[model samples]
Target: MNQTDQLVDLKNLSPDALVDFLEGMGKEKFRADQILRWIYLRGVTDFSEMTDLAKSFREEISQRAIISFFTPETIEISSDGTRKFLFRLCDKRSVETVLIPMEGGRNTLCISTQVGCAMQCSFCLTGTFGLERNLTASEIVNQVCAVRKDYSVDNIVLMGMGEPLHNLENVVSALKILYASKGFDYGPRRVTLSTSGLVPEMLELGQRIKVNLAISLNATTDEVRDELMPVNRRYPLSELMQACRQFPLAPSQRITFEYILIRGVNDSQADAKRLVKLLHGIKAKVNLIPFNEHAGSAFQTPDENAIRAFQTYLLDRQIVAIRRAGKGLDISAACGQLKEKLENKLLGSGKESSLQGK
Candidate 1:
């Protein structure tokens, strides 16, 4: 057998899987815990650094197993202190992860589950790239671990580049690692999975994982939503809202409906009224994201007055809604601005080009 095949990546295994693998290797069950502690709790990558293990045992295990971690090809820091990391995968595919620092020392990390996206939301930058591939559980989990090396991330959002529900299995498997006490150890509430209203997967996610859910609900009616997010056409607003209603929620928890307000599209007093009516009986909070404009996006950011008026309309009706401030815009690290910079580098033209036509 190839030695590389014999070498298991401990980072890819869950605690139970690690136990089984170690047992099969004729090593003590406790070895699994020791190795995991060194990798996760201690943040040690090399076997030589795991001093608690006997030198001979470490050498033997080193030859039979390996710990894998993805290092970023480029780390870009925005003027606003946001950091975007472009990680080059083993297969040479690239993905971006971002770290956003907030008030009171709280920080949130945005992670990507897919290389590109299939949702094809008309206004999203990543949608323009189309679907490249879904990330593996290790690929997903490593994002959190890697960012933790720099900033003590207090929360995580699956809102980086792709529709997380589109890669449900791997996303959920990665969540298992993030929720594991012996792994990333992030509380379920602190991790939010944002989807473009994938009803079936949303229901499954609520059942399988206890993390918070955020829906990218850019429109109030099927006609408008179909234009903004194509996924809405398949799962329509009614069915998506029904899934939200059926989703089990812990006490004091409310689903976050993210509405990206675009000028001349889905940002008018009439639209806001329809949205209030549509969310009738759902336990929800609203995040009004004034569309993050990119070089080639047809959408324009709504004026502050228009955004505030829409927010005021929601607030008057007892809806908890807030206009989310755009971050990392200088470095193209905002919601819909993530793709162009990487795409420019990939093309090797060194000129800032939009993927809109491509």
Candidate 2:
């Protein structure tokens, strides 16, 4: 086989899979652990830099296994320290990853699971592109690999361009690598997978892995939800709520229900009360996101008073509801706003003003 044909991307393998692959190469499983630390912890791509590995073994492994990373074609930095990275895939399709600075010194890396979305959530701009393709396990994991090159990612959210549960297999494998002690070493608390109410896959994901689960629950009733999220039609509020209740969450970990508050749509006192009623016994918190208006989307951001009133109503009922600020608002990287920008390329050195039509 040619050299390129023999090479396998080490980043794509889970800890167990990597060990098995190394064993196939006549190396001990412990070698996989050492290589994982070198790749993830040290961010060293060159096999020669793994000083502990014997020189001859390094040459053999380097010939058979490869570390693959694709740098972002463009990066847009926000004033609030949010960095949006646009990475062009090998197929020429691209997806965006956002690094959001949290209140503390840590940063949250928001990565995509699919090239586009099939959910067709009315408010989400990504769905406008339709489901181009599901990302590979390597593609999903490499998004983190690309970002960690410059920033320390304390938290990772599979809440970017597509519905994570749609690409269940690849997404699960990527999560396994993320939580591997020798890989990224992220615990359940540090990683979250947000789904657009895919009932079966949500439960399957809970069973397969222990990452935090967040549901993109926009409306309280099925009628309103059907108009906003098409997936609600398949798994209505009743089925979805039942699935959430059945979800395996740690005693300390609560499922996050992401409710995007849209003006004159599903942002009312009655809606808030119904939300409280819906989440009655379920261990969940409401992440209230005021709809981030983008081009082609008719929805408007709710008034601050309206947003606060919604939160206050939930708070009064003893539910934990927090309003999430649109961190990358200025750079079109906030919630439900990665629209036509997907077709355009931001030129120059990652400046917001450098936006040019593709």
Per-candidate count of clashing residue pairs (backbone under 3 Å): 0, 0
Q: How does each model score on TM-score?
A: 0.92, 0.93
Q: Any residue pairs clashing in model 1, and if so which?
A: none
lDDT of 2 by residue, 43-80 (tens): 88899999999999999988888888879887878899
The regions of model 1 sitting more than 4 angstroms off are 1-6, 26-30, 349-358
Stretches of candidate 2 above 4 Å error?
Answer: 1-6, 335-339, 346-358
State the TM-score for model 2. Answer: 0.93
Worst 10-residue lDDT window, candidate 1 = 349-358
Best by lDDT: 2
Candidates' lDDT values, in order? 0.85, 0.87
